[model samples]
Target: MKRILCTTALTVGALIAALGLPAGAAQADSTPRIDLRVLVVSDGGPSTDAIAAELDTAGTPYTEIDLTAADRPVIDAELLADTVDGRPRAKYQAVVLPSDNPFAANSTEMAALVAYEQTYGIPQVDAYTYARPEAGLQYPDYSGSLDGVRAEVTDAGRAGPFGYLDGSVPFEDNSPSVGESYAYLAQPAAGADFTAYVDAAVPGTSQRGSLVGEYRHDGRRELVVTFVYNQYQQQFRLLARGIVEWMTGGVHLGASRNYFAVHVDDVFAADDRWNSELNCTPGDVDCPDGAGTPDPIRMVPDDVDHAVDWQEDHDFTLDMAYNGAGSVDHREDHNGVDHLTDKLVADRSRFRWINHTYTHAFLGCEQDTTVVPWRCATETDGSVRWVGRTAVVDEIATNRAWGESVGLPLENDELVTGEHSGLKVLPQQPDDNPNLAPALTDTGIAWLASDNSRDPRQRQVGPATTVPRYPMNVFYNAGRAAEQVDEYNWIYTSRAQGGSGICEDYPETSTCLAEPLDTATGYAEYIVPLETATALGHVLSNDPKPHFIHQSNLAEDRIAYPVLNGVLDGYDALFAANTPVVNLRMKAIGTELQRRAAWQGALRDGRVTAYRVGGTVTVEAPDGVAVTATMPTGTTLAGTAFGEAYAGERSGWTPSHGAPLTLALPSSAAQATGTAEPASATDPAPATRVPEGTREYTAAH
Candidate 1:
C-alpha cells in the first residue's frame, strides 16, 4: 500500500488556525489539493511573498522546498527520488527549480526525476534555469536585479495569482527567485475581494518588460519566473484565479488548434530567442535586426528551395528537411530518406535542417522482416513501413547519428524544450504514439509530430469509443473561422503520398477527410461553402475563431489552406473594425489603458465573476479574518469581463485573399501537411474495422 505523506505544517489553513482569528462561523480551509510545490534549486530572492499571499488566499498549499534554502523545508532524496537518503521530503506535489544550478546540477541525476515522474507522476519545473546556451557556460554574462513598487499592504486580502514584469525578478545564476507572477489574485478563502500586486514598470526602465521562462511539464506547471502576477488585484481577480487554476493542473492543452506547438528541432540558426537568421542571405551575413526579423514568414504552402533564390526574395526561412531518401539520387551528395545511419544537409544552410528522421519513418507503422534494408520493404501501396522495436531503437539512434552528421553535441539543457521561446504556444497535448513518446524521450525530442490521419479535426475518437488523442496534432489554420466553415480540402501530408485527403483512400484509417462545416446546404468542403457556414449559426457572432498559425505549420497551410487563410484575413479586418475584440491572442489584447483601469478597480462589482478548478480555496484579510470556500465541482463564468468591446483601428488590416486549396501556394508545399480531421459519418465506410489493440490518449481538446 502506498503511504500518504501529511501536509506541510506551513499550509495556510494550519497557519490561519494557528493565528486563531475567529467567530461563531468557523472558516473552512480552502487550500486546493492538486499540489503545486516549488523547490528553489538555486537559493535567493525572487520574492515568494506575492505568490505566497495569493496562494494563501486561494487556499492552495504550496511548499517552498528550497534545494539551496538556508532554512529549507525538510525534503528527502527519496522524496526527490534521489538515491541519496531524504524521505520525509517527498511529501509535496511538484518540485520547482528557479535558477540554473538547481535545474542543471541536481538535475544531473535526471533519471531519478524520470523515475519519480513515472512512479509518483509529479511534474518538475525548471524556471529560468541557467547554463550558458550560446557559450555553453553555467551562467549568463552576469546577474540583474528587478525593481518594483513596494505595496502599501503586503498580503492584501486577495485570491489566486497573477502579475507582470516591467522590472526584473532579481536572481543570481542558478538561484531560485520567488516573485509575484499571476495577473491578479482573489483570496476567496477570506471574504475579501481581490488584489493587484504585480503591476506596471516603476517610473522608468527600458523598452518592454519580459518573462524569462514559464512552462508546464507532464501536466504540472513550473513557473521559471514571475514577470507579471497580481498586477491588478481585485478587478482582475477572476483572471488571477483563472491563471493559477490553469497553472495548478499543469498547462491544460486547450480544445483547439489555437494551442500551436512550434518545433524547436534545432538550435536557433541565429542568436537565440527562438528567432533565426536562416532567412539571411548566403554571404551577406547581415543578420536581420531582432525586431526587423519578420515573425517567421511561414510559407502556408511549403516547397524545397535548393538555394537562397526564392527565400531571399520572399524573406522566408528555408527548412532543409534533412533526408536520407534524397541521398539515393544525390549518396553522400543526395539527401533524402533511405538510411537512418546517414543523411544530408543544405550546404551551409544545412545548419537549419530540423532533424525529424534520416528517412521519414512514420514511427507507428510496420516494416518487412525479410527485407535486408528496412527502407526496401514497402506496404502493398508502396508506403514505407516499420513495425519492430529494433527499427524504433534505430530511429532513436538516428538522433545521435544526425547530431554527428551535423556538428551539434547533446547536453542536459537540450532535453528541456529550451523554455519554449514563445508563450502563446500553449502546452503540448500529451503524446500520441507511446512508443514514439519513449523514442522522443530517448532522443531528447520533447516535441514530436502526431500522425493525424487526415481527420482535419485533430481528434482521436475511440479505441473503445471516441477517446481523444493526447498531444493531438494542431493543424495550422491559415485563416479565420469566418472564412473556413465547410471547405472540401485535399490536405497535403507526405508529398510522396500526393497529399492524402478526404477524396483519397488512405491505407490505415481507410476513411478520408470528412470534417463537417455544418453548412445550410449540408456539409461541404469548398472555401466559399465553408465560410458560408458561419452565417448559418454553426459559428455565431462575426468574431473570428481563436486560430493559431505556428511558425512551422505555416509551411503546410500556405499550400493546402491557401483559401481558408486568405479569406480569414478578411474576417480579421472586419472583427478588428468592431471595438470589442472577442477572440484573439489574449496577451496581445491586454492593453495598458485597460490594464491600468483593471488595476485601479480591484475586486470589481459586475466586472468580476469568480471561478476555480479545485473545490478548496484560501482567503485572508487585514483584520486577520480568514475564510475558506469549498465547492464540489469546478468553476466557470460565462460572458466577457473587459466590459464593452472596442473595434480598434483596422486601417492597417489587409485580407490575403487567394485561390482555394486547389491552387498551390508557393513555399509551404514543401513541408508535410501537419493537421488531421477526425473520422466522420460522412466518410465512405471502410472495408475493415480498426482492430482493437492496446490504446490510450488524453483528451487534449
Candidate 2:
C-alpha cells in the first residue's frame, strides 16, 4: 500500500472531534480531497483567454468549457464534486468565469457553481468583470483610458499573492495616438466585504480606486478584475501569476520561471559590412557587381576585453558561437598571429562557447546565386545537388578540435550551423539537406540550434533535437548604429517612404513604417526599446528560447548593450529579488522543452494523478517521468525539503520513481488565508448599467 505523509500527526478521533462529527461517523480515510486542477469557463473573450494562456505556459492542467460551443458540458454539482472511495472529492481546486455572472441571475448552472464553491471552499476568478455592486464595487467613479498608468500593489497584495512584484504595475502605452489600456476603476460598495489588491489614482482626483480586488458574498468568493487586457500585455502578464496563485491557494500541479539567454554568433569571425551606396552588403546576393570589396567588421582585442567586462558588470553570461577558421584565416593574413583570437582564448573561461562550425559553411544544398534571389543548384536531370555529408562533418569536427586545442570550454554535443542552414529554406531548399542529419549523427551532436523564426517547433535531425532560437532584429552585418537603423528602415518602410517596400508586400508579418527613421537617432531611441520589448515578452511568457545576434553587434558601436540593458532593467523594475530571471544554457533549455512536452502528454492522457487531502499532497506518475509542482515554502518530499523557493513558494521538477510521491505540507499551511473573507449571509445589490465609455473598452478586447 502507498503511504501518505503528513507533517503533523492527527488521529481519527481528533479529526472527528475537530469536525464535530459523531464518534462513529468519521474515519481516517474520509478526509476531503481537492484535485489539483482548474476549471475555466470561457465566453470567447480575450481576458479569459489570457488567463488560460497563463495556465498553459505554467504547465498547469485545466479544463476549458467554451460557453459559445453548442455541445459544451453543463455546469452541475455532479461534475464538480463526488465521493471517491468514501472520501469527499472536489473535482477542481479553483474556478474561473468570464465575469461575475455570465449566466442568467437565477440560472441553474450559476446556482450549481455557487453551491460547489461554497461547499469546497474553492476560489473563483471573475475575469474582466464590471466594477458594479454585484462584484462588490460601486459603479465606476472613474472609468476611462488607463494607458501609462502606474498602479500599486497594496500591502495586502504583498502579504498575499502579489509578493513577487515590486509594488508597481505600469500599464504599457506603446502609442500615444492610440488607447492601449481602458478600465473601470471604482471604490468598494458600502457594507461590502471587498479588499483591493491593485489600485491606481483616479485622474483629476486624489482618490484611489481598485482595478483588481477580492469580493465575498453569499458564501462564495470571487477575485474581481476590472481592467481589459489580453495575454500579450505587460500589465496582464505581471498580474497573471498573482491571479493564479490566489485562486489555487499557492498550490498547483505545475511550475513557471522567467527565462532569458543570448547567443552571440560569429564570435571569432568578421561579418561583411552593409553598403549604404548599394543598400546591401557587397558579399551578399543582392549587391551589384563593382559594389566594391567588403569592408568586414571584425572585433579587435579591446572589443574582447570590453565584452568580458560587460558580462561581469551585467551579471550575465553570453554564449559565444565561434568559427575557428575565421581565426586561422586572420592569422594567415596577419603574420600568422591574430591578436583578437589570442585575447579571446586567454579569457575564454569567462564565457560559455559553442561550436559554430569551422568556416560557417552552408551545409544545405548547393546554391545558385546567379539570379537576384538565390535558388538551389540542380543537375541536368533536374535533381537538387547537395553539399556532401563529409563536408558538414569536417566543419563540425574541425571547430571542436580547435576549441579543444585552445582549452576553450565547450560542449561537444551542442552545434549551431551557419545561418541555421542544412534545414529547410522555404521556396529555395524545400527539404533539409539529406546529408546534414547524417553528419550530425557522426559528430555525436544531441542538441542543434535552429532559427525560431523559420521553424519554431523542435524536431529531430538524426539523434539531435533542434533547439529553436529567436533571431534578434539586430542585423548581422551592422557594426554601427547608423548602419543598423538604415537597414531597419529599408525593410520596414514602404516604397513611398523611400524603402524597399518589403513591409508593404507582406502586410501581415511586417508592418510598414509610417516614414523613414532618422538613422542617427533611431537605433538609440526606437530600435532598442522595440527589440527589448519583444525579447522581454518571451522572457515573461515562460519561454526558454535563446535570442541570437551577430558578433558585429557586440563590436564597433556595441549597439546590443542598450537593448540588453533595457530588458534587464525592465525586468528588475517589475519583479522582486525573490523572482530573478532564469538564464540557462542551450542544452538545458532543450531539456526543459523536452520535459514539458512529456509532462503535458501525461496530463492530456490522464496518466498522472495529483490531489491534496488536508496537509498531505499526493502525486503519482509513470516511472522516470518527472512531476512539476508549486507548494508552500516549507513543504517536503521524501522527508526532505522539496524545492527551491521562488515568488514566496517552493517549486521544481522531481522524478517519480514508480512510487507515489507524497508531500508533507508545513503546519502553517493550514493557517493560510483564503483570497477573501468567509462567506456572509447578505446578497449584493443587482449590477447597474456599466459606466459611460465602458462599452468602447469592452469592444476593444
Candidate 3:
C-alpha cells in the first residue's frame, strides 16, 4: 500500500494498519476530510466494475449520480463534474468509477469525462470495460483470451525485501470479461511511481491483471491495477484490493454530518405553522395519523405540522433554549418544556440547539408591521426588553448546563444568538453592539451568526445590514407570529441573506430583501445551506460529512433544500474514494486554530519562520515549504504572515518605514515585487500590510 508521509499526526495509513485506530483517535464528532465531488459517468460496465472493486476493498463510501435516477436528464453538468454535489471527488482519498466507460466513446463524451476529472483529483480504477469501442484507448488497453495460467511467488527480488507474496486473484463478484482494461499510457510519470507486475500471460494479448502501477494527475497519486482476465492465476481479488487501497491513499475519515435547527422560543404552542392536511389527526377512525399513511415514509408533512409533532414524523425534538429561567415551573417560563436539562435527555441528536437567551429579546428594535408581532426578543417582565449582558451570560450557562446533562459537552455547541434584533443583521458599533466583546467574553460563547454580507472585509462584524439566515438550521421568527403559521412546516424560516424588512420579500419574511429568492425560495435555500454547510464543515474538520437531511429532518417537518440539494446530490458520486466531504464545524475551526497557534508559537520560539504570500501562508517549520496552501480568505487574514495574502487587496493599511503599503504579489502587478517574505527582526520592512498593522505587527522571526 502507498505510505502517507506527513509530520502531522502519524500518517493515517500507518496508524490504521500499524495497530488499528484507538477509538478516541478519530472520535471527535465533527469533521469531513475530503474535498468531495461526484461525476455521473456512463452506464455500468467493466470500468464501472473496476472502480466499484477498488472502492469496496477500500471501504470508502461515495454518492452515486445516476442520470437514470432522474425522470429527465436536467441535472446541472457542473455539479455532475466528478461531483454529484458541490463537493469534488478528487477531494476524497479514494473514489470509484461511476461506470466502465472511463472516457466517453466519442469526442462529446470524452469532453465530459475530462471535465469531470478536472473537478475531481483522486485515483480511479478502470475495469476492462472502460475502453470505448469507438474511441481508441487513452491508456494502455489490455484484453486477451485466457491462455497460460499459473500461480507462483515472485522471484523478482534482488536485495533486502518485505514478505510480499506474488499471485493472481479474482474479485468477489467477477463476471465474464465484457471488455478491455486500460491504464494511463504514461505509465510512471515524473515525481510518481508505477509498476506493472505480471503473474501470467496469454499469447499476443493482455497480462498484468493483478499487476501494480502508479501514475500522477495534478500532483496526486494514481494506482493502476491492470485487470487482464488472464493476468493472474490466483489471488486476483487480494491484489486488486491492495491496489484500490493504495490508489485511494488508503485513508478513511468519518461517514457524514447532517445539519438542522429546531426552533424553541415562545411559539411552542402552534396555531398555523403546519401543513393544512384535511382530517389527518384527532378523530378515531377516518382521521388517524398512522404510520402507513399516504406518505408512509414522511413522518410529518404539511398537514401534520406541529413542533416536535410525531403524528407523521421522525424522532426529533425542537430546540427550546429561551427565557424560561431554565425551570418549567417558573412563571417566566416562556417555553413549557424544561428547556435547560430534560430537553437534552429527551433527544440530543433530534435537533440543533441555537442560543436564544436565558430570556429572549427583539432584535434591531424594528417594529414588525404585523400589529403585535414577534422579533428575536422573547417575553421577560411580561414584555420584550433588550437581552443585554445578563441575558447573554444566562443563555450560555443554561445551554451549557443542559448539554452537560445530556453527556454532550457544551463545548460542541457553538453559541448562536437568535435576537439578531440588530447584531447578526447590522454592523453594530462598539456603542451600538448590544453584545460587546466584554459581554461575549462573559458568555464564553464560541460562535456567532451574521445577518448580512457586509463589506466582505469583516471579522468581528461589519457592514452587513441583516443576517443571511438562509440555508440555516434555525430561524427565530418561524415560531413567532400567528399569520405565518406555515413557517413551522419549513426547516429554514428566516429572511434571505441580507434580505429586507420583516415583511418585505427581499428584505422581509416574504423574500428577504437582504438576499435572493422569495420566502419560499429563501427558506428552501436556507435548508440546503445547512446540509451543505454541515457537509462542508465536516470536511473542514477532517471527519465524515453527514448525509444530508435524507429522511425529513428527525422531527422538524421542513422539506429538504432542493437547488442546493441538487448541488450537493453529486457529492455521493465518489463513494469508492474515501473522500472526506465534511463541514466547517466550530470544533474543527478551533482545532485548526490550535494547530496554527502552536505552529506560530514555535515560530516565535525561534524554531521556524512563517511567511504570508498570495492567498496562502507558508509555515517553514525549520523545513522549507512544509505547509502552504490557501487559508480561509476572510477579512481576518490581513495582518499576520498567515493572513497577509488575503489582506493585500483590502484597503485598510498604510505602508510605513520604507515598506511600500502594498501586497506581496507578482512583480508585474502594481507596487508589487513578488518577494514579500517576512523580514528578519533586523529588517526594516513592516511586519504586515494589514490596515491595523500597528495592532497586528509582530517581530520578524
Candidate 4:
C-alpha cells in the first residue's frame, strides 16, 4: 500500500472539499486517476521566473516548489520515499528543473531525486546547463565560454514542442549589451534527439554544437535547452513560452497563424482644403510670429490610392473607419460627395470599412452631471451633455447610413467614436457604465474602439465590446503637435532633455523650424516598441492588433506618411527575415477580438475552471456557464462543457482544431439599468469613459 506524505496539509477529503466535489466523487481504486500537478524544482532564479511567466501567459494554474528554501532540508532516502504527494513515485505529470546540473553541489539529493524521476517516468525540462561530471551531465567539446551564436530550429523541434513555429526561428545578435548567447556548447550524445543546433563554429574550430537536444530516459522524455531567460529578447521569450507548453503537454488556445491588423481612423475622402498644419506657438525659439497657416496642398483621393497601392504591393490589407460627412457626386469634380469614398468603394477588396460616427460627435464631457441625457437632440444637447444613450445611437446610425449611401458597405459593423468621445451617461458609476449597454445594443455595433486605456474593467458594456488603443497615435489630435513632437523626441533620443537630434544644428537656441518627423526617428521612437509589444503578445490592446494609423497620414509632407512608412518598413524588414506576421484587415481581427473578449469574460466571471485528469483535460462550469477552449489535435475533449449530451463522454477523434472555440451560456437581454450609485462630480472620470469630450483626448474620430 502507498503512503501519502501530505505537504500543504491537503488530504483527499480536503482536495475534494476545495474542489466542491461530493464526498463520494472519488472513483474506485481500480479506476485510472488523473492529476493536474506540475512539479517545479527551482532555486528561485530567472529560469523559475521564465517558467512562471509562460504558465501565467497561458493561464495555466500551477503550484511552485522552491528547492533553495532555507528551512527545507536536501533530498534524502527517507524524503525521497515520501517526496511530494508521497506516492512511491511523485504524483506529478511533469517536472521543471531550472538548472541542467540540478544535482551539482548536492550529490545525495541529486541521486535521490534522480531515482525518483526514473521510477516516476515524468517528462522533464532542463532550462540551464553546465559541464558537471558528478551529475553525469557533460559538454565534451568544452568550448569553455559562452558563444555568440545564432540559434536555428530543426524540423523535429517545430513539431515536437512549439506551437509557435511551422518553419525555423533564429535568435540573432540584437545588441552589444546582450548579444545572442548559448551557455554551453555540447555535442549530442549517441542516439539523442537533437532538436536545435547553433550555427556558429566553436572557438577557432569548424565545428558547431547542439543548442537543444532531447532523449528518453527511464521511459520519460527529457529536454535540454540553452537560452538565457533574462536576455529579454522577443525570440527568447517565445521559445521559453513554447517550452512550457511542451512541458505541460498543452498548446496555445487561439490563432494558428501570427497576424496583425492596422486600424486607420477618421478616413474621410481627400480633404484638400485642410493641409498639414505647422505648429507655430508663442515659445521663444522656433516660431515665426503669427505664421501658423499652412499651404493647402493636402492629400487627395489620389494620395489615398497611392498609399493603398503601396500596401497592396506589399500584400497587406487595411481597415479604414470613416466619419460619414463626405458625399460622392458623379458630375465632374463637382460631385457633392468625397471622392475618397468612391475610390474606397472601387477598391473594396483591399480595405475593410468601419463606421466612425456621423459628423464626429463628442460623446463625453468634463464635470457635467446629467448633461448628456440619453434622449438628447441637437449637437448642443449631445455635445454639452457629453454623450447620452440617444446621442450614441444617432451617431452610430448616421455614420453607418452615410457609408451605405456612398456605395461603401459598412460590413465590419465596428464603431470607433468620432473623437473617441466616451459615453458620459445620465448615471455614471465609478467602475462600470451600464448605461452605454443599451445604446451599444441599439446601434447593432458589437465592436467599439476607444482610446486612453478605456475599459480597465475589461467587461462588456451591454452589447458593445470596447477595444482601447495605447501609446497615442501621432496624428490622434493634430492640434497637439508640439506635445506629440516632444514626447517622440524623448522616446527617440537618450538625451536627458527632450529634444530631437535636429536641435544639434540650432546650437544657440534649442529650436527647429518645425516638429521633427523622419523615418529613422519614428522607427526608433514609435515602431520598435510597437513591434516588441506585438511579439510579446501585448500590443495596443491586451492582445496583438494592428498599429493604428490615420487617413491624414497620407497627406503630402505630413508626419503621418513618414511614420506610417516607418511602421511598414519595420514590418517588411521583419517579414523578410522570416518572422511570422500576418497583415490582416480589421474586419477579420474585429471578429477575432469579439471571440477573445467573450472568452476572457468567461474566465474573469469565475464561471469556469480547467484542469487535466490522466491524459484528458476537463473544463468544468457547474453554473451552465458556457466553456469553450481550443486544444491541439490528439487530445480528447468531452463533458458538460462540450455539451450536456456529451457529459462524461469522449470526443470521437479529436474535434478539428481551429480558432478558440467559445462555450458560452446564453446572455440575458441588456436592460436600460442605471448604475448602483452615480459617480460624484468631484471624482475622476471612470476608466471606461470613452475618449471623446475631454481636452486631452488621444483618438481620432
Top model by lDDT, which number? 2
Worst 10 residues of 1 by lDDT: 251-260
User: Residues 632-700, candidate 3, lDDT per residue (tens digit)?
Assistant: 213232354322221111111121222212223222321111122322222122121111111111111
Question: Cα lDDT of model 1 overall?
Answer: 0.27
Q: lDDT of each model, Cα atoms only?
A: 0.27, 0.83, 0.32, 0.46
Candidate 4's C-alpha lDDT?
0.46
Indicate the residue-level lDDT of 601 in model 1. Answer: 32
Sliding window of 10 residues with minimal summed lDDT for model 3:
689-698
Write the candidate numbers in order of decreasing lDDT. Answer: 2, 4, 3, 1
Candidate 2 residues 81-153, lDDT tens each? 6555445567778889999999986998988887677666778999998889999999998888999999999
lDDT head-to-head 2 vs 4, winner: 2
Q: List the residue pairs that clash in candidate 2.
A: none
Better of 1 and 3 by TM-score: 3
Worst 10 residues of 2 by lDDT: 692-701
Of 2 and 4, the candidate ranking higher by TM-score: 2
The alpha-carbon deviation from the true structure for residue 604 of candidate 3, after best TM-score superposition, in angstroms, is 16
Q: Which stretches of candidate 2 lie over 4 Å from their true place?
A: 1-30, 288-290, 671-701
Ranked candidates (TM-score, high to low): 2, 4, 3, 1
Give all TM-scores, in the order shown.
0.26, 0.91, 0.34, 0.64
